[model samples]
Target: MKTVALVYSQHTAQTAELGGRIAAAWGSEVVYLDPDTTRLEDWMKYERFILGTPTYFDGELPDSWDEFLPELEDADLSGKKVAVYGLGDQQHYPVSFADGVGLLASYMEELGATIVGETSTEGYSYEHSVAERDGRFLGLVLDPTNQPELTDQRLAAWLEQLKVAFAG
Candidate 1:
C-alpha cells in the first residue's frame, strides 16, 4: 500500500480528526507539523503527502506551516503526488478557509509535487469528514450552513481521485 502523510496545524482538533479519517480510509499515517516534526521529512519521503490545516480568523494562515516555506526550497517532490486540505468554522473567516492549502500547493509545485486535481473546501472539518475520505485539497467556504454534506463528500471524492491518480 502506498503511504500518504497528513500534516496539519489545528486548533479545534477538527483537522486532526480529518487526518484520522484519511488515515483510516487509506490506511496511511497522520503526522503533525506543529513544533517541528520528523514527519515533515515524510512529506518528501512518502509516495504522497497530504497537507491538512485549519484556517484562522480573517484568513490568517497557521504560523507553524510558514516554516515549510524555506525548507521546501531544498526538497524534491518531483512526480510525487501531493494534496492539501483545511478545516474552519463557518462563523468566522467567511472566506479564505481553503487558502492555506493553496499556499502549500504552490510550494509543493516548487518542490515538484504533482498536484493531483481539484482543491479547497470550507465545511466538514471534523471526524468522518469527507475531506479525509476523498484526500483532495479543500477550502470549506460555506460548510454546514450552505451545504452540510458538501465538504465531507467532496473530501472523500478527492481522496478517491488521489488513489486513482497515483495508481495510474
Candidate 2:
C-alpha cells in the first residue's frame, strides 16, 4: 500500500519532525510532502496518509493547511485510512491545544477517510481542544515545547495503535 506523510509547519519545525517519526514507524515506503511543494494530485496516489501540522494562534491550522484542505475537496478519499498528528504549545494555548488536529481530521473525515491514531488526554494538561472528543484526541497530540520528553514514548504507543487500527 502506498503511504504518504503530508506536513505543514511555521516557525518551529516540530511538526515536520513528528511526521518523520511517524513515517519511520510505518516501516514502509512512505513519501514525505511539504505543503508548499505538495500537489493535491500527489496525495491522491496514496492509500494511507499521515498528516501533521502546528496549531496556529488560538485553535487553527497554519496558512498552508488552510490553503491545502480546500484543494482536497475535489479528491475522492473514500476507504482511505489516515492518521493525524499535531504540535502545539499546550501551556500557552491550553484552551485550544492542538486544535488544528480537529480541523484537519474533520476535513479528512468529510472526504470519507477513516481516521486512526486517536489518543488519550491523560498526560496533557490542556483545558480544551477542538481535537478532543469523548475525552480522547482525534489524533496524536505532542507538545515538543512543553513536554518534549514524552514525544518518543507517545509516538511509539500511537504507532502501535495504528498497527492495530489498520489491521482490523
lDDT of 1 at 117: 51
Least well predicted 10-residue stretch by lDDT in candidate 1: 124-133
lDDT of 2 by residue, 1-168 (tens): 345554555333778766766777777657777776677787777777778888899997888887777778878889888888888888999998999999889889988998998999998898889998899999998898899899889989988887777665
Question: Which pairs, if any, clash in model 2?
Answer: none
Could you tell me how far off, in angstroms, the CA of residue 69 lies in candidate 1 after the best superposition? 3.5
Candidate 1 per-residue lDDT, tens place, 1-168, comes to 465666665443667677677777776344434424443464556676676766555555676676556666777777777767665554444444445555666667777777765654333343322232255443322244445567577768777877776575
TM-score of every model? 0.70, 0.90
Each candidate's lDDT (Cα)?
0.58, 0.81
Compare the candidates by lDDT and give the number of the best one.
2
Candidate 1 local lDDT, residue 144: 40
